[model samples]
Target: MNKIDLTITDAFKNKVINPVYLPYLNNETRTQIYFGGSSSGKSYFLAQRAVLDVISGGHNYLIVRKVARTLSKSVFNEITKAIGFLKLTPYFTINKSDLVITCVNGYQILFAGLDDVEKIKSITPAKNVVTDIWIEEATETDYDDIKQLNKRLRGKSLVKKRLILSFNPVYQTHWIYVEYFAGKWEESKNCYSNDDLSILKTTYRDNKFLMPDDIRELENETDPYYKAVYSDGKWGVLGHVIFKNWRTEDLSEKAKPFSMFQNGLDFGYAADPAAPTHNHFDRKNMTLYILDARYCYEMTNDLLAAEIKNMIDRQVITCDCAEPKSIKELRQHGVTAIAAKKGKDSVNFGIQWLQKLQIVIHYTLKEAINEFTVYKWREDKDGNVLPEPIDKNNHIIDSIRYALENEMAIIDRPKRDRPMPKRGAL
Candidate 1:
């Protein structure tokens, strides 16, 4: 064995290995995910584990992050620090140009990042045996992209392989978390053990090395609405929604068939484009599906009329509404368009109604989804969820509420009626 590999092994034996990492070391699964809040020693543990694998006669291990910049800034520094602190210089040499470490025993550690889609596609394993693959900040990459990368690690007959992921919880409601970890737990009615393919949770509390002040700071600074998500890893709703129970998948499958289609036009002549959102309402299911979106800048009434005619020809739009001039123009073109009557109160009412329902959305309308995810309630001085003025960046959601309010008017009727109060003697 090379002197550096020996030294690295000794360091892992003495200073690096901790009880917290034992579960991972003992886990038999080929895939593992370690996710939690910030500053929980996840990265450090991952690096140390990879080094141990290399020193133990492993020939093909890779340490990767989201991008080259992050590898250079964070992961690179952590590995170097471990190498230096462990006094492993004599046993191995770091090839700076190729970003690899080679030990005397022929084991190799390659460092790379998977930020660009093309770069990820171009990656080919040096040997048929890729023993280890580590991804830091795994959430930044698309879930489907990660799945594709996992398929590339097929090994030869003699090779054994493993994949590790580390991420801080950010989007709890995101598809990846919801489908894999949360869904699994909900089905099994138990926390994921080391035997499971997924490890859905970890927290700063699990790490003994964090300073008290740091923990206190995170606890104090995080807003109440977001504290459970960021600190405790709980799932909850975010921002304004027409249907709180509604998700993108619901709209595609259950609500599409019953839709009564219409269009909502927000008009602008020169400064901003005339933007129209095509909507389909399924009255039977009490769901609204936003089918398509179109915007054209600085168009004359003649051109706008042609566009409206094309849309009508495609499907029967029961009604359409726009601003006063746009409405008059549509009438002149022999299409019946009226100005929609809705005040702030009515708009808010629609949004509230939508929030109460379970709805699904199509993924292609990412802009609308983004708007919904970031829409938040106003918070008080003490960082509490409060009913008050709306938060910022809610224009898209507002537009959606406007369209739905005009078309759908289904309200939740009470199941039981309260007896009228008995009249007292005047």
Candidate 2:
């Protein structure tokens, strides 16, 4: 095989580079995911592969970021720095306006962002025909948009096109890692092949290139939680949760509105338990406050119904939806119970809607608040993170999702045009 002469920089050589990177450079794998703590040399290795692909004459590659701003700051600079460091500029034309680098031998490297739908759509891989696509900070981009880009890469060549994703594992349940990497292995009950995909995990300890001072600073950080999350890549709960941030200590008696109260139920029977969340929508403040939560394990329909009745009798809940049977029984007991819309997509819609809002929940709903703190994006073997499945274990969170979905239509009402009263004193 004819090979182009490439020089390894002293910095690159000194770094604790993973062996997985070498296979990517040799085009032995069509897909590669590199993940680890910061300073793991994943970015540096990706730059090397991009340079190699650009110089080899037959392939075109793309370096993708979440947004154009990030593309300019991170991915673009990384590639250019690699080119300069390796003294490969003589063989490539760097086009800043179009974000394309054309090699003397006809290969091209394109820099692009995935945030804007139109920007992503404008690039026809059929025309340029990318051999490989590199997604930097893949966690930040939308999973749907990434899939759209994958569909566009119908390269002219017979061999399958490749995708390279590199990021730190921020969310345990992110879709990229879950569906593509971990999900597949779990389903097959065996290790996946290179033909399937490969995830190379690296950590800060693996990066031998960091200065002693830099390493010392990471070690000497005062906040143990920050150090664990940032430097060690260990997952832990920290900071005020999404809903907890909105809590108020004062729940003193105030004029209660005659507004209709509703409860959203996310059913989990056995180990996970069913969670019913009461939401009080104060139209006055346009805020939906989680008034209470009832989480019970392995309860019969009769037992669940009794619990719902008790909450209603105590004036803690006026209306609720529990199990399907419980909802029917509550209706029989003169309490209005409505069955929640059941579907994965519907649940997702609710979750997404709540995420977009400046939501506040009462301080008493600690379990509901805790769920949001730990909820994270699922990851794939290639280190791509996507949203996880909505399941019974996340009953309270799912109930919140359902409530938000149903309430959004009413919450999103447009301002009404008022008739002009006669200009009184004109």
Candidate 3:
């Protein structure tokens, strides 16, 4: 086999990298974190990206976990799987006992654990200095472990010396979150980046190839806290959650037989995103079905009009009243748009209205799922839960509130007295 084929193998990579991770293909951040729920493909994607990085340029890449025994079944297996997926097995030497892969060109991929400090210290690549490091299950290691490992990538070269961390966020108090994500509430989005740091948040929804049974199993999770942390891939909040009457479902098929369809819009730009949603209400069953929701940035009225038409042409879309000019422009562009009649205390009233019925969100709406998971009542400086919710991380939800405003007058179906679900107290 010609080694040159490996150099021009975008085709192989196409089969390896998932669509959700395509945005970071050329990432040069000093610190890149691939974190979310379990089975989110974060670890696998990291291994796959590292495999491609090794071929594009020559370097010593170290992949580590907390213990030596765990590396074989986890990151090590993922690396070998990535090699097989990209059909690059012929160009590299895999030393199973040493847990190393060496390219024909003398670049190396090394595996170690913090437990084997001397082994990690003795490691040196044949051709290049340590150019990259991936700390798998990073939550297992402390701040000092990363501080020492960060020093390993000493000499610079043609490529960016990246320090990659992959883990399922297990605790809000974890060092990683406090260090990099304490004040940034918007970090729950699909992607967040600054100059030298990048963060990607994903859930099972982002993995399109997941089997139906696998999805069913995950969505069937009953423990609210477990579902939030593992299934939805958001940092679970234990108390004072606003909406527990809602759950995610495979709604594309479930909502097909419904007769009524309406839409909603919440306008945003720059720091905030334009949120739009398609919904259906069942008066008798007291169910509000969120069929679709989107979080988009830098969208203009023309683009928003186009997006509305694409979702459901000619449907009555209730939009924020403050954007009357936007509504007028949308009307000019042929969108059946109107303003929502939000009166005094409309935000609180909307929350009260929604809390009365069961909400079933479409399983694929990842951003919306995250909003539902994290949206909580605001608190005063002394930590009293305010009547209104925190304003951010709630664009999709605001659209839902606007979309279903007209139905609030409908006589609510007799709700069974059931205990509201709460995240387990940590």
Q: What is the C-alpha lDDT of each candidate?
A: 0.58, 0.59, 0.78
Model 1: runs farther than 4 Å from truth? 1-14, 95-98, 124-128, 157-159, 186-191, 194-200, 235-371, 381-426
- TM-scores for every predicted model: 0.56, 0.53, 0.55
| Candidate 3 lDDT trough over 10 residues, lowest sum | 417-426
Residue 291's lDDT within candidate 2 is 65
Query: lDDT tens string, model 1, 23-71?
Result: 6654547778777666667777777666655655644677776555446
Cand. 2 Cα-lDDT = 0.59
Off by over 4 Å in 3: 1-12, 239-426
Query: Which lDDT tens digits does candidate 2 get at residues 1-426?
Result: 224566665466334344545544555466677766677677987887678666754567777876564566577778888888766778777777778777776667887776466766666432247777888878655567578767766747533578778876554445566656654433212124566576666656766667888788777754433555557754333422223334443332431553456566665666576676766666666666666676655666566666666655423332224456666765666544566654434544555456555555555454555466454443334433344432322667776665554566576423212221222210
Compose the digit string of candidate 3's lDDT tens values, residues 37-70.
7678877777777777777665469999876766
Deviation from native of the Cα of residue 11 in model 3, angstroms: 4.8
Among all candidates shown, the one with the greatest TM-score: 1
**Which wins on lDDT, candidate 2 or candidate 3?**
3
The regions of model 2 sitting more than 4 angstroms off are 1-20, 124-128, 158-160, 181-194, 222-225, 234-286, 289-426
